[model samples]
Target: MASVVNNVVAAVANASNDEAVCGICLDALDRKRSVTLKPCNHQFHRTCALQWAESVRPDIDRPCCLCRSSVREMVGRNGRRVVRSYPFEEEELDMKRQVLEGLLNEGDSFLISLNNTRDQIRKMLKESEIERAIAEKQRQPDEYVVDIDQEGAKLEKRKHAIDNLLEYGATITALGDAATVACAISRELEALNRSNSDLASEEEDGHYAAEQSHNEDTDSDSDSGSEEEIR
Candidate 1:
């Protein structure tokens, strides 16, 4: 499957307002960056979609938050293919399996980094709020007032950073989900091919055994006829 997060992000960046409401974030689709999944046609705010995708486990298919359809394909309103996946040949499947493995690993690493960044941001925010509280309790000196304002600004920035990191985490999680599905499909196809091969081999062996038995029987009959004729 295609990179789920990237496709959703592209659709969001390019989308215009619609009358639909996002089921994930419960926000008006007309008020936010939105995407309508193909086939299912379920609309969601892009950020909300990302958050939902991030919450899904990477070992399974990422489904639509509303209808639970596997999020494999998506197209934009402009008829542009946002994300489309196709069945792969055996060789291509092997390659995709390998690539997805690497992608999952990288995605995991990126998510860990995002989590660390978020934690740091929250820590800074908390520390700033505490400092601001202390400043408020003291006399309203000019320097203290400046300090409070600066702390407020820092808190705002930290909160923004945390929000941004959360978005990034969602993107990474979506990518991981896409990779997981692709890998699972690749493995299943490979297993099916192997099973078919085994069945063919067994049928060939059975035919060969029948032919050998028939030949042995024919030889025995000929020998019996010769002995009877000589007697």
Candidate 2:
């Protein structure tokens, strides 16, 4: 085991000290035209790596062929490279949060508008009621017989207006109720998505832990076998 580790270390040291061939093109690496990737320290021709990076879709980072290390920067169409610097998941999460916040704000505004409309409807009904009462109280018995038709017409018109107002108010109230329910359902769905995501992450972590434990146990058994052979 020690010899294997030493051999791996020596290989890495030699690669770092000497100029190695480009992994992609399998040709000699030029000192000025080569790039050493981070973390992996694998060397490759700058042009060859750039071409490889550009061949893959730009939406995802490219991984090194030799060590599978992530290459966060890619050569753009205009030959400019930009660093991602942040995780894609984090960016998506931020966008979702912004959208949810906007939805909540719009919901608040809608509710406020509905409340104002209801208040205006109530105020109009109260004013109309008070006017009707005063007009009736001011009428004399002689005037009542003469203006009965006119009064009836006015009352009918007023009643129609009141009925229309009530209908409009009811429609608006129903819409508001529906909107409230929809908002609640959306909230529940968002929570369910989050719960499912968390569960999946937990399962993945448990699987990784189990795999690592198994690997360690296998290594231990191998070491025991070597010790017995030496004895």
Candidate 3:
């Protein structure tokens, strides 16, 4: 009896290992217990399917699986069709991808804008620093102060500093605008990162299947272009 049981277990294991199924759909069990079996005999990777279900239906009262007619019927008892509750479709995924790409482009543009603004701010700061240094030099009771044109020189320097202060104020306003844009871009990038991570955890092939790599490359190119604009 023990030998018979061992043979049966081996056969089941072999069948599971040889099984071919879509990792995304989780239709067939590729390995024994790779996915837990429902009481209804429907199978899914325990973690993968549960996360997918949660995303589709946050309420636990909703049907547990979308792959079976029985599960649909169960959900229908509560006056909700399972299909209506889980509205994830291929078009929706495409929409999400497009949204992510848009966000990435926006981020890159904002970063470039901020960099330009920062450069202007640095130039203004440097001019201010130079003016301060020259003012200190004039205050020193040196022989240069006795020069006939020293007073005029000092007045010129003072006027230049005043003009630069006005320019600095304008630059500061530009910097503020850039900062606000950068903050918005940061939030968008963070959201995209979260979505990418969530998609990644679905399965080993989830990123590839979703074309995430291709999207990332496109985003990178956009970012590089922004960097070039900054330069």
The residue pairs that clash in candidate 2, if any, are: none
Q: In model 3, what is the error at residue 32, expressed in angstroms?
A: 9.6
Cα-based lDDT for every prediction: 0.49, 0.46, 0.39
The whole-model C-alpha lDDT of candidate 2 against the native structure comes to: 0.46
Q: Indicate the worst ten consecutive residues by lDDT in candidate 2.
A: 205-214
Query: Which tens-of-lDDT digit does each residue in 130-170 have in candidate 3?
Result: 53455456673333223213323433443444343333233
Q: Candidate 3: global Cα-lDDT?
A: 0.39
What TM-score would candidate 3 get against the native? 0.19
Off by over 4 Å in 2: 1-16, 74-231
Order the numbered candidates by lDDT, best leading: 1, 2, 3
Worst 10 residues of 3 by lDDT: 76-85
Clashing pairs in 3: none
